[model samples]
Structures are given as C-alpha cells and as structure tokens.
Target: MSTTTIRVRAPSEVDDARTGPATGRLRRRIADNLTAYGFLCAALVCFALFSWYPIIRGILLSFQQVNFVTAPEWVGWQNFATLFADPLFGVAWRNTLLFTGLALVVGFAIPFAVAIVLNELRHAKAYFRMVVYLPVMLPPVVVAILWKWFYDPGPGLFNSMLRAVGLPDLAWLDSTDTSMLSLVLVATWAAMGSATLIYLAALATIPGELYEAAELDGANLWQRLRHVTIPQTRFVLLVMLLMQIVATMQVFTEPYVMTGGGPEDSTVTVLLLLYRYAFTYNDFGTASAMSLLLFVFLGGFSALYLKLTKSGG
Candidate 1:
C-alpha cells in the first residue's frame, strides 16, 4: 500500500518549541515561591523578635548581671551559684515537684475520667459540658480570687459545708499542709475543662466497632477500658500528663494571689521563686539563671517523655 511520507521535526526544533513553556513555568514557579516567602517574612520577623530573641536574651542574661539601668556585666556562673546557695531553692524545687505530682494524680486523671463519663451520656451533654467549662471561661485572676473567698476560714462555703455536716471547720489555705492542696484544687477547677474537652475529642475518634469487638470477646467495662480505651488514647494521655507537669511546675498566680507563697512558704513554686528572684530580690541575673534551669529541666523531661512513649508505642 502506498503511504504519504511524513516529515519528522528536528530534535533541536522540538526542544526549542518546548523550551518556551518550560521557561515560563520555571519563572511562574519562582514568582510563586517569592510571593510565598514575602507572605511568610512578617511572621518570621515577629517570631524572631518576640520569641527567639527573648529566649536568646534570657540565656545571655543568665550569665550577665543587669539591673535595667547600667550595662550588663558578664559574671560567668555567679548567678547560678547564687541560686544554688539560696535556701528557698530547695524548698521551691520540693514544692514544685509536689505540686506537679499532686496535679498529675488529681487534675490529669479527673479530666480523662470525666470525658469518659461524658462520652457515655446520651442526654444533658451540652448542659454538663457548659457546667464543666464554666470555670475555665472566667478570668484566672477572678478564679483565684473566688477560690480565695471559698477557702476563707470564716463563713466560707467549704467551712459552712463542713459545719453543716457536723465536721469541724478546717483551715484550708491557712494550714501549711493544705495550702498546696487548695491551690491544686483551684488549678484543677480552672484547667481541667480544656483537657477534658481534648480527651472527649480523642475518645470520639475511637471506632465504636473496637468496643463492640472488645465486648464480644467478654471484656467487662474495666477490662475494655484497660485494653482498648486506654491503649487507644495512650498517646493523648501521655501528652496531657507531660503538659500538666509543665504547667503545675510553673504555677505562680494561685500562690501569688492566694497565699503570697506564705503559710511558711509551703506553696512557693519554681515560677513563684523565679518571680521573687526578679522582683522581690531585684536580681534579674539569678532569675534568668532560674528560668534557664527550668527551661532545661522541662526540655529534658519532655524529651524523656517522648522517648518513653515512643518505646512503649
């Protein structure tokens, strides 16, 4: 059969035809990238100025003495040495650790348990959620002040209830023994809502079929929770646990407003101690050193937590 001869275009010609669109695409991509970077520059600059600069400056200040008046004088480890020598340093660490442990035991689990219960409810969920989160909506200062009134020895709600129940009126914040617990109570009331909501969200994501299968295997409520619920939500629980530790360790406002770290300095936390170093003692260098120490401790704790969780998972 006779066929018409077709002329093939030269490779160079074909490349030339393709080059224009390729160059256009490259230019367009460069332009898009430049536009994206231009948009990101403002956020980058703000983060650098506000966040990164403060962290670097704080570290530098830890090694230097400054009074917001004269030039900062570099003093090596003098600030850290002074902090270590301070009598309140050990007390602060002890109180902070105690608070963190108590908060973990009380504040951390309560939210998860509440979330589990709330998840099972078929009605009044909205009302219960609103009630649970109501305290969180109030200002922290207001909550502290409110709890201060609640913990008052005279005509306070707690004492009134105790008296009504024929129990002796107990000194809540006034006692060194109960001051930290009182603070933990208020913190739990104010903070547990967020964690509860987070847990509720995590619980919702769990497939119902898993529970059905678990039940089919003759698992009871506690068994199912231990085997399925906990393991499924283990990551979230661990994250919340670490977060509670960090927050409790840095406690300040409750003790500052309620007890002023009083009742024999029983409620003094690491952050409250840091505040004293900076303001009460007028020693910025030592405060910076303490802050750096706290940062390092929390960072190490977080790293350790991640490692443990990863290994467990």
Candidate 2:
C-alpha cells in the first residue's frame, strides 16, 4: 500500500545531467592535450636548434682538421690517436684521477661527518647551520684568490703563521708535491658547506620517535647514530656522493687559476688539458676528441648512478 504511489524519473534526465558535463570535460581534455603537444613540439624545435646542432657539429669537428680561413678536412681518427699519444695527456690523466680520489676521501667524508654532528646539536642549530652553509654563497673565483694569497710562497698568511710559530714555512701551492693537496684542501673547504646543508636536511627528515625509542632501549649516541641515523640518510648520501664524483671529475678552474696546471703539470686535469689543446695549441680536432672521451667517462658514471638508484629503491 505504501509503495503504490512510487514515481520513476526518466533515464534521459539522469543521462543528460552526467553525460553532458562528462562529454564537455572530455572535449576540454582533448583540447588541452593538443595545446600541450603543440608546446612540446616547439620545445623540441628549440632544442634541435640550440643543443643538438652544436653536439652534432662538435662530433663532426672531432673527425676533421681546419685552419681559421679554410674548410675542415676529414682526418678520420688521427686526432684521437695523436691525443692518446701525447706525453702530457698521460700526466694529466693520472693527476686528475688522483685529485678526484683525494676529493672523494677528504672532501666528501668531512662534510658528511660534520653534518651528522650538526644534526645532533640540540641548541644553536640554526646559527650552526648558517655558519656552515655561508661559504657556499662565496664565489669560486674569490675562494681561489683568497687561497692563492694565503698560499703565497713568502709573507703569506699560512707560511707567515708557520714562521711566526717557529715552524718551517712549507711551500703550500708552490711545491709540486703539495700543490694538488693545497688545491684539494681549498676545494674541500668550499664544497663541504653545501654538502653539510644537504646532510642536515636529510637528517632532519628522520623521525624523532625512532631516536626516542632507541635512547629508551639504552642505545648510546654512537649506537643510535650507527643503527638509526646512517641507515636513514644512506640514500641521500649515495646521491650526493655520485653528484660530487661527477663534479670533481671535471675540475678545471681551481687548477687553471691557482697553478696554471702547476709547477710540473701536477694539477693539469683532463678538462684543463682539453682547454690547452683547444686554445693554447689550436688543435680543435684533438680537443674535441678529448671532450668526447670525458663525456663518455661522465656518461658511464651517470649510467652507474641510475642503476644503483634503481636497485636501492
């Protein structure tokens, strides 16, 4: 008796309400896709003009010889062969590898350790972080100049202090043996600030409750750090490590400005050698060949980084 008065709405009415808007929305989405694809096509065109063209040109240049006024002549792999046979090239390679290895050990480790220490500080955290990160804001040229003055052979701040304190005034950047080490120290000092800031950010993201529980369970500071802090920050640390390795591999300005490839080509990095070949020697083909080789090394590192990141995830 109660259900006898029921009324039904037409299916068309419901369909009109939902389907009209949905169809309109679908049309808008198709229009949006068209606009997006149009922009992507424009970007591709720009990239071809600016980026791809130059890379293609460089590749071509690597196989040819040209004077300033003449058209380039195809010389095949002669330039690459000559570059590999160059006596200085071997020295440059060895020094570059040494500097990179030293930077990884000294530069990378110091910042990570300092960041971990800073994260544990309960008071003046902001001030400490600011102090640590301030150096990264300074220009690299300024950093190199400051270190140059400090490392001056005589009456320099470093040697003068040593002399004042009745110690030997060691040749900081002048000696071939210590020149690379001095450069590494400056680079480490300049770079550690940013690395510390990154590590600090990573450390802050770790949950507070984990530390509280660890402490409650009678874990000491070292134990807590080993068990909790390091594990949590390992991913960020690996990412930073790979980035640093890539950057350090291309080191040029520090050696170029500081020592001009040093007392005995002691600090001549691979990039510096490439620059020397291009500008100083005017051997474009050889320089381009070296550039390609350097690119390959970097590409290998990048590929490794991607593989490790995927596996870690």
Question: Which residue pairs clash within candidate 1?
Answer: none
**Steric clashes per prediction:** 0, 0
lDDT of 2 by residue, 253-310 (tens): 7998899997878999999999998898888888988888888889997998889888
The local lDDT score (0 to 100) that residue 63 gets in candidate 1 is 99
Candidate 1 off by > 4 Å: 1-18
- Candidate 1 on 16-121: residue-level lDDT in tens? 6788887767877999999999999999999999999999999999999977878899999999999899899999999999988888888888999999999999
| Pairs in clash, predicted candidate 2 | none
Report lDDT per candidate.
Answer: 0.92, 0.88
CA RMSD of each candidate after superposition: 4.9, 5.8
lDDT, residue 105, candidate 1: 80
Kindly give the stretch of ten consecutive residues in candidate 2 with the minimal lDDT sum: 1-10
Tell me model 1's lDDT, rounded to 2 decimals.
0.92
Off by over 4 Å in 2: 1-23, 37-50, 308-313
